[model samples]
Target: MKSNYFFRSIHAMRGLASFAVLISHSLTLYPFFEFRAAAAGVDIFFVISGIVMCLAIEEDTSKLDFIKKRIIRVVPLYWIATGLSVAYIYARYPHMSHSWDWIIRSFLFLPQQPGVDMPILYTGWSLNYEMFFYLILFLSLFIFKNAPIAAACIVAMIASFSAVGNLISYNYFFKQIFIEFSLGILIGYFLKFGGRVEKNLGIFLIFLALVIFFIHNKFASSGFLAWGVPSAMLILGAISFENSELFKRNFVKIFGDASYSLYLVHPLVIWGIEWYVLPEHRGILQVAIAIAISIFISIIFYKWVEKPLMRFLSKNL
Candidate 1:
């Protein structure tokens, strides 16, 4: 089956975001240099999710059909990753106790309450926000026919709720991140209604550089601005440079195809390395080794697990 050029472009962007996160984590593990800017990768992913989900819904399809397709796309791989991570945690830390309710909440992708130990797959926390975004988007479709209006409303509601939730309680990770996903929806609306962003090579390069500088300076100081500003700029860059040669290589496309798997599985690989290989090592060399191991493991997981699942879903579902 052939995918559209637009979808392929989104896939390529996902790959870039995943690699950015990898670099960020590696730098964080070391002492001398810190590149917290990498965390903006998740913000980019959320935006891409919003754009792609809206695009998918633009086709003539019933709500049930839309829900089914999403479930098939997200649930199978998510559950597999969750289950493995939980088992790994249990095996590694046999004395660590967790409640059955916490397990249930994580598995169900429900909003985790404060003081609960997050799931073993630390990155799985993002999936909860993604599921929440889906729920909001699904409900909005019934109340509003205009996709852009619906997306804008969703973004505003999430932002308002996030601000209130943060004020009430200090711990609001889920609420805060959900806003990033909604921002993506707003971007999608812009893409649909505002027409293509005009591309000027020089201006695009300048915007990209400014985005990097902004993310690097702000990520360590301000969590909200770190992801929010750079994510917006990244999406704008992506849409404007859709046909650019910067990301049109075969290897890049392959990485993009496997990015979801890499994102879901890399934490486990990192944890395993920390547990067995580098428990005492905090050197830059150890950081490089950790990153290399993660990339190797993620590549295998992507090729064997993620690619096959997506292919099966596309063909059978």
Candidate 2:
């Protein structure tokens, strides 16, 4: 398949967001900076997921086929990661005791039961949200037959959920974060409607404003504006604007290709650094070591696991 500049840019941004999450998690070790930038990275993924899914599914496809493709794409890698985490926990803390309940929950992608500590694969929680988004998208396939109607519905739902989330408890309202997915879908719809326009400077400025707003608020309303809106704009702008030759270089393409593996594996690397490598270390040294380890692990995982699995999946599925 010929790679488009739009998709390529999205991939690059995904890699950047994944690395940002790794850095954010690393910063948690220091006393000076407690901010978590990693969580914002998940929001970025959510938006991209929505946009990509809409674009991918624009052609007629059965819900079963769509779901099957999703499962093939997501489940295998996820299960492998979860299994590795379980094995690590068991080996390292054999005396601590094991709860089959948590294992089962994690395998099924269910929410962790109250008072049950999540497995070493705590990052898997986001996959639950991803699965939820897929279900919603699958069910709405018929209702969203008309792209404009679908886009309108998505926007309305996001607005409603945002209002509800703000007015109510986070637990009750937090599901509204899925609105980012809808925002992505709307972006695809707009693109389909010939909405491409040259506005890289404007889009970049908006993205900067959103980032500043997010940093100021520490992502309190990021799901709505900082993440959802800006990500959509970025994708649109990237698609509309002409891409430079530099962006199409082999190194950038490789990073984009490895983005997913980087995202999936970085958390475990971060946990390892925090828990074992430099448990007592503090300051910039800790951050630097953690980042170094994360990058190394990300590269290995991408080369050994992600690329091979994607290739196999593409061929078999």
lDDT of each: 0.70, 0.67
Off by over 4 Å in 2: 1-6, 31-38, 116-120, 142-144, 147-174, 200-207, 214-223, 237-242
Q: Compared with the true structure, what per-residue lDDT tens digits does model 2 show for residues 157-200?
A: 64576555346533422455667777777776665555665666
TM-score for each of the candidates: 0.86, 0.83
Clashing pairs in 2: none
Candidate 2 weakest lDDT stretch, 10 residues: 165-174
Candidate 1 lDDT over 1-317, as tens digits, reads: 12342655577879988887777766645645766667777887887887777656663547776676777778889889889888887889899886777777878887567676455567777777777677776776676676535765666565666666445664444355556666766676666665576677435843874666565655564445556656767667666767777568888787787787778777776676667665456678867876777777778887888778878987887
| Candidate that scores best on lDDT | 1
Best TM-score among the predictions, by candidate number: 1
Supply the global lDDT for candidate 2.
0.67
